[model samples]
Target chain A: MRVALADDGALFRDGLVMLLEAAGHEVVGCTADGDTLVELLATEPADVAVLDIRMPPEPDGGLSTAERLRADHPELGLLFLSHYAETHYLIRVLNIGTQAIGYRLKEKVGSVEVLSDTLTRIRDGEIVIEPVLAQRLVDRPSSNRRDMLATLSDRELDVLRLMSEGRSNAGIASLLFVAAKSIEKHISSIFMKLGLPSDAAEQHRRVLAVLTFLRSVQDSG
Target chain B: MTLDTYDATGSARRRADEHWSRRRDLERQLHDGPALRIAALTLRLGLLAQKARHDVGGLPHDIEELQYQLHLIQQELRAVADRIYPPLLHEAGLGPALRELASSASVRVDAGGGRFDPAVEGVVYFVIVGVLAALPPATRTVDVVIRRDADGLALDLGDVDTGQIGAVRDRVRWVDGVAEVGDGLIGTIRVRIPCE
Candidate 1:
């Protein structure tokens, strides 16, 4: 596959480009911003274009560019990489009039095989979603407000509902009458079920999950 | 007759003195309120402008991702300007201004029949942008819910990413507001700003 990589992060974009090239994919162009990516696409068309969801201008600026590309250049396969599993981006990806699209969390590119497989799938006309994101689609609770409480496991769901209400570990501990340490253990378990790593970015991922769940519920309603 | 005349004259002088004091007090309040408001507005705008400039320079340079971040900054700046002085709020009202701000993100906004006093709208706008500006690099989408009820204006900002919830909370608190961060992979921020 001839790939064009776009990401404002030099380190990340460089690493990804190297990975793709090592996997036998040809990288035709590299850009630090979306405008450059657009220009590259217009002039030097590639079979696939991999982009970071957020980049220069600001961290949240790349989504519109992605939409524009999907509209203008339907033949080019689109893939989005981000630090977070943003549902908004996912929905946008799903709405794009092509099936050759993919969204993956940056951390999930831990192996060359996974990245190459995703690129190939996108190039072959499959909507590739990261495993973590796929889990979200399966685990999303039903939107029936009455059944919403029942859709989650007692512990895993409690953590999620509190999370949606914007409670911290300490806050949840106080609310649930448990130790903060115990709350931490429950959260780790939740992360495992959700296919997310429990690390410094865990809280951010949890927020992303809750937002996805909420948005799904909102959409269903 | 002489005694009656003296009492009437004394009473009249006392009433005149009381009326003069009341007038002076009212005049002081009238001058103070607007002067203080103007000073506060000026200071707030200055601080916001400085912060905006700092944020622009601090923007990351992952060129592939530049367009996304650039769009976010543009949306934020517009929100900041509308907040500082809502030409829209003054003309079309709160709903129109918020709708305009929300349109930039391509996200659906449900305002819930909330109305903003012009001043409240200004504060809400700045607070929203300031919180957004403070967001760490990982956050993707920001869901802003501005509600005006018995407690004034409450802003519920839910970020699509939560990695920097602690930093976001600290920054929000520094602005003299309360931030509630939910535990999960994604983060939601609930800020309550009193109308007063």
Candidate 2:
């Protein structure tokens, strides 16, 4: 997949480039600022845009950029990367009704295989979210929420709850006392049972789901 | 024809009044626009020149970090240079250069130093000449001592007017160095340059 990776941190940007390229994915463009990222997207089309939620010029919300891109170019697959696992951001992305949109925590970017798989899934029309963020929604103790969890297995629910808190697979493994390999299997099952799209870009759906769940919780509170 | 001649005077008076009003407008513009611009430009240029002197004048000390003592010496040098042989000191080397400064001021200077780098010699020379120029017209004499030790070069500037000691000390502190004011109102500025 041709990917456009945008992040303000110089070290992280370079690392992502190396990781993506090593995974046999061609990175079309990389930028340190939101304005430059928008410009790059116009000139260079990519299969998916992997963007940081907070970029230069303003360190806070990247919702404006995301909103602009969704309005102008609906076909462009968008993935928002963030350090924080706030659920409101996920709701905003999903509300756009874009099938390939994704949200992934930055910490989960350690392995190239997982990152490439996620990117590929998003390009294939999947709505991906990180596993830990998904677990937060499943774990929320509410009659209305329990109905949502009824379709997902107990293991999938567990993963979703952890995913909500922005924990990576390694983090979930340690918490569950299960092997990291088992965590991956459980995450796949969660996606399968949730009727979530399993496009290669599904990693973003995990983040989006958790973000949406968090927003719902905040709104209710 | 007689009526027309009478009206000519009235017409001439109105024309004159219009001319005077136009002249006043031009004068106001000159006062508020170009003249103010020129003044602002002059102040900016003056600050630039002062900053340039502060930077370029200390080139010879070659010390990594300029101490307060060295800065004071440079400030005094600028004040003195502004008064006498200003451009020459910047253009020429220090030995005969400072002599020119002292001679112009009618001050007696006894200066001797072994072969030193041009920069070190320039700073020492400027400080000596500067302190002499700073002295009040009533004060008759000033002394300058320059020495090279194992640690670095030390310049002892003595006999600066007591009243200016505070000003001199403040200037020295600006450069991250020290100054000592003695009981005799002797303003001693000691600048030590580490041997490179």
Candidate 3:
């Protein structure tokens, strides 16, 4: 994958370049802030653009840049790295777009393996959320929400948590040590229980299920 | 007329002192926490890079320690960030932010939900936090009511320590708000800030 990036932090940017190179992805452009990254992207194209959520030109310049990138190059993948895992940032990232996008903690994505997998998942047009954020949404006591979330059994909740993390059926099966077929059954059951339409495409259904979970948590907060 | 002049000068001096004290605390927090950890991480990373070239087998444990240090830096930075301006205050608005604050507060907080002017929200939110922090350690429970009405926003705090009432009054008065404290063994503070 060809990647362009922006971050005001020189050290993190340099280390990220090293990590991406080690993972075998090409770093097409590196810049300090969103403005420079925008100028670089005009000529030096990339499959994905990694950005820091807080940077120069504005505190939330990365979010503004993502909006611009979405408008100019709708096909490009976006990954936001941040030091904090606040829901507000996640909501802002999701507001830009849900597909072909990811929001991961800066420390969590330092490893080559996680970085590579995150890039691949975004390129595949999946919504990848940080696992810590996913855990918060899932671990909120069931009694707090009187919606469809309460109907999910403990095992189903586990599957929902992994699904929110952008895990595929096979990936989830491998992690949970269950058969692929069983994973499929649990997912379909989840969709039905959540009132998601059966005819919708798998990707769309997954997004809807995740959206339901998030909205319930957001409203209750 | 002379008494009024003296009162004005006294208040001005107090404000200047408070401003200076806050700056000093901020500097101390930054220097003592994330700043020191980040400097240490730079050396550790340099060492790890060298080790990676020669001793790949020992790299995993070294990397784990680096991650732990990074985590601590993040936590420290979060405290600094909250003091500057809680991200939630601007991102999610005041109501949700207050609810989040309530979740972790030592005393129970019933923060009613409603959006107001951002500046007003900031003043009110911080005032509540300040008042809660000032309460006596032995004081266990206090009820906080934040409500919005046609006229303005009202905050009713119960069981405040008498010693902190004057400070609370000054903070609220800075925003052109009225704060009335009850006279009793345990006090209550009622504040009203009009919303335009």
Candidate 4:
């Protein structure tokens, strides 16, 4: 996979380049700010662009850049790396677009497996949210009486969480050591429980719908 | 009202400005220095752990423990940095920042409004957080509303006594804003700051 990165911290950028190369992904270009990432991507296109949410031009320049990049190049994957896993950044990142996007904490993404998996999921047009943030979304106390999330059972909540983490039903099934068909059943049951309008045509879109639901829940609270 | 009082307020404002800047700088240093360096090291260690796994069929327990310890340090550093200065306040604005601050508060805070000048936001955020902290342990009910009208930004704090209003007054006054206690023993503290 071809990956571009923009982060103000030079040390972290260098380390990221090394990690990506070690993970067998091409580091197309590396820069220190969102503006430079825009320029770099124009000249050197990448399948995915990893950004630090806090960078030059503005405190949340990465968000604005992601929005622009998504507008200009719809196919490009975006993964935002932040030092802190604030749900606020996750909300903004999801607002940009649910597809081919991810928000992961910097410390957590150090693992090559996690980084590689994230890039692959993004390239596959999935929304890759950090697991911790997803767990928080599940655990947060819902003030609204009509909160659909409260309807989900513990096992259902686990499925929804894995779905939010960009895991395919099959991937989730493997992790849980369940059969593929059962995972599908659990997911469909989840969508029904959450009162998500049925749209069985596209699996990824369902994941996105769940993500959008989570975002709305976060916004309301 | 008098020159002495005016100079004192000016000096106090200057001190607040300096304090905010210092906190911001310290936050930046923590963010860009040790935080980044530690993160970089974590990345390298991750790669090393992968190699160890490939060669030894699994990660050594000590290496895993070291990585866990480093991750904890990173989290601690981030918490400290957020305390020194919330990055969200600078990145996102007062509303989101206040909501983040209020999440941990025992009282309810309906943090509404939008972006204002950074200086105005700093003062309002600082004053609100300080006031909330000073609430008595037994104090149960408190209301915080942040709104912007034709005049400027206004923060209305209900159920706070006059005693608590003094610090609120000084904090708001530093930004050339007005903080007034309503007509009751335990009244609301209304603060209005002009925003351009």
Candidate 5:
């Protein structure tokens, strides 16, 4: 598979090139910024374009690249790597009118084999979502959304509902007279069932989950 | 004077004063504390990761992964720093800062260029950010151009709704700037504040 890579961070970009090359994929194009990525994709023959969601010069370099790539090369596979599970960015990604795209967390690229597999899968016309963003889709208002949230038990729902109110885990624990560890467990379960990631970007993940929970209720209201 | 008149004037003054104090506190905390600490930590990690990668016979997978994770951590911290106080607004100036804000949102912001007071630049930087932020992501395009007015610096924010300018109006007013937000297909938020 031929892949093009774009990221402003030279270290990360070099690591990505090594990963792709080690996996036996051709790194036909390399660029440090977004506009160049779009340009490279246009001229270089590549099955997939992997982009960092944020880059320099443009506040949303990755996003602008996505827009240009989708518009200019509709058939080209796009795989966006982001630092956070930013739902707003996700929404914009989806709105670009292509289903065969991949949005994955940057840190999760640690699994090079999985990364290569995802790129191939995306090239084959599947929309690959990072677990966190997948959960957000499940939390949106719909029958499927309700069924997904129903996977959480009554206690879990109570925890999530309180979380949607912007209470910290410790605060919620105090309110419910439960141990902080137990609240953490429940929140973990909430994330697990909703498809959010379990990692160091805890604040971003928590906000994404709560935003989904809030949207579900707001829509029902 | 009536008690109601006294209360209204007093309350207005109090609210503005409180906002100024809160902004100062937030700015001081960000500038003097967390932002520097985060930048230092990021630098330390980068150095460590670089050493770890070379200190080993070859590029160790664990150290490489550590490098990747540190990069993410560093980016998030910088984002937090920008949210608290935009670094570009200070280091580069308003035009670059506004451009950063526009590019981040994937919206086009064409800002007029001129060096101004730091406070004026900060106010304009955030007001444009606030206005763009309040608009639905559905809003695809916005134009911001500055002008040298006879009285003050003039900012014309085109492609905005009157409602979208509420946040901008409040911030502009804080610096004793005049704001005119109106409704149209090209709803505009025009502001002019004297340089302090």
Candidate 6:
């Protein structure tokens, strides 16, 4: 797969290039920060773009860049890497679309094997979130929200959990050993029980379910 | 003024919390983004070193030195990140954040409270941190109380040194709250912030 990366640190970016190239993936493009990354996409296209959430100096460097990339090239994949396990960022990126996106903590991305696997997953149209992120979302205080989340049947909740992790309908089906159509039915029921607007986009509704169940309790602070 | 004597509704309190929340959010972003990149780099370097050691011949001297340098960089970066904003500040609230601050301070400190508005909590944390940072090395035994009240929340820090009160007063003023600072070495500071 052709992969492009953007990070302000020269050493880290150089290491990533070596790591990706060593793993036999084509390093189609590289840029120092998100703005150049967006520009790189116009001419030197690649299958996916690995972005650092906060580039040097600018606090939220990659956020708008990814938003623009998603808007401009719907088929292009995105995988976000950051140091902290903050869910608000995850929600914003997931709301972009469930297709071809991945997020992992910088510290947790251990080896070329893991990064390559994630890229391959995204390339195959899966949402990839690091497990720590899922744990953080679960740990977020949901004092008033427990009942609503508890309404999901165990099997339904399993489907919602995988959906939140960026799994496709077919992917969830295979994981649960169910049919894709039943997974769709489970999702429709999840949405119906949550009282989401019927006309909302399917992707938006999926994100909404995840966001509702594991909404960042820290949004207040 | 006693907590109940003054009117407690003020727009600045809301605005202050918004500002502080944004500040904390920015700090967290730095912690998660750049801080983690260095960590990932360290891991990758370790992986490379492990490969050079086992799969290949003995580890290359150059790889060994590079690994040591990266380890130092990661540690220094982590320290810088923690000082920029301790994760406890956002996670555990003002009481824990302050305790973390006072961990190394020369003076003895006591602090506790119920949760309040994030902005109110932030002001309390930062003000106390600033105050403790300026306390005389000879100073000892400060007391702090933070609790929710009918109107909003009250924070009182006693036995404060006079020199640091200016910064504390400025922060209180920004929030449209009042800070009562005593005149002598054994001074007291009390603040009542509206819940707005």
Which candidate leads in lDDT? Answer: 4
lDDT digits (tens) for residues A34-108 of candidate 5:
888777776787888988875754666787778888888888899987654544465556566435577777655
Which digits, one per residue and each the tens of the lDDT, describe model 5 over residues B1-196? 8775676644754575565445545754653354334433333443344445546555455555564665566457656766765655544466656644543353444455467765566677778878777778754467678876677789888787678666777787766787887757458889998753
Tens digit of lDDT per residue, candidate 1, span A1-221?
89997786665666666666656789999998888888888888788888876565443446667777887787778888765453445655566633677777664543445567778767776566665555444354323332443444777666666654445678679988999998888877666655555564754665555545535534431
**Model 2: chain A TM-score against the true structure:** 0.68
Model 2: share of native contacts present? 0.00
Instruction: Report lDDT (Cα) of residue B150, candidate 6.
Output: 80
Top DockQ prediction, candidate number: 4
Give the count of colliding residue pairs in each prediction.
39, 37, 0, 0, 4, 2
Which stretch of 10 consecutive residues in model 1 chain B shows the poorest summed lDDT? B35-44
Please provide, for model 4 over A1-221, each residue's C-alpha lDDT reduced to its tens digit, 9 standing for 90 to 100.
99999999888899899989989999999999999889888878889999998888676889999988999899999999988777677778878998899998888877778789889999989888888778766665333423566777888778877887888888999998999899888887876776667755657556655665465445443
User: Candidate 6, residues B27-110: lDDT per residue as tens digits?
Assistant: 767655666556656657746854665444456556656655654565566556555555556665666555434334433333
- Give one digit per residue, the lDDT tens place, for model 2 in A35-70: 777888888888888887756546333556766666
Model 4, residue A91: displacement in angstroms?
A: 1.7
Docking class of 6: incorrect
lDDT for position A199 in model 4: 54
Q: Write candidate 3's Cα lDDT for B34-132 as tens digits.
A: 644463354345435444745757776677677667766766776776775566665455666655554344344555647765556666777777887
What is the C-alpha lDDT profile of model 6 across A1-221, one tens digit per residue? Answer: 89988987676677777777767789989988888888888888789999887774265677778888999888899998766455556666777766798887665554566677889889888778877566445433333444566676878777877877777799889999988999999999999877788899887788777776554233212
**TM-score of every model?**
0.43, 0.39, 0.75, 0.84, 0.44, 0.57
- Assign candidate 3 its CAPRI class: incorrect
Q: How many Å off is the CA of A143 in candidate 5?
A: 14
What is the full ranking by DockQ, best candidate first? Answer: 4, 3, 6, 5, 1, 2
Comparing 1 and 2 on TM-score, the stronger one: 1
After superposition, the stretches of candidate 4 with alpha carbons farther than 4 Å from their true spots are A145-147, A199-205, A216-218, B1-6, B57-61, B101-112, B116-120, B126-143, B149-152, B158-189, B193-196
Note the residue pairs that clash in candidate 4. none
Query: Judged by TM-score, which candidate is best?
Result: 4
TM-score of 4: 0.84
Is candidate 2 or 4 superior in DockQ? 4
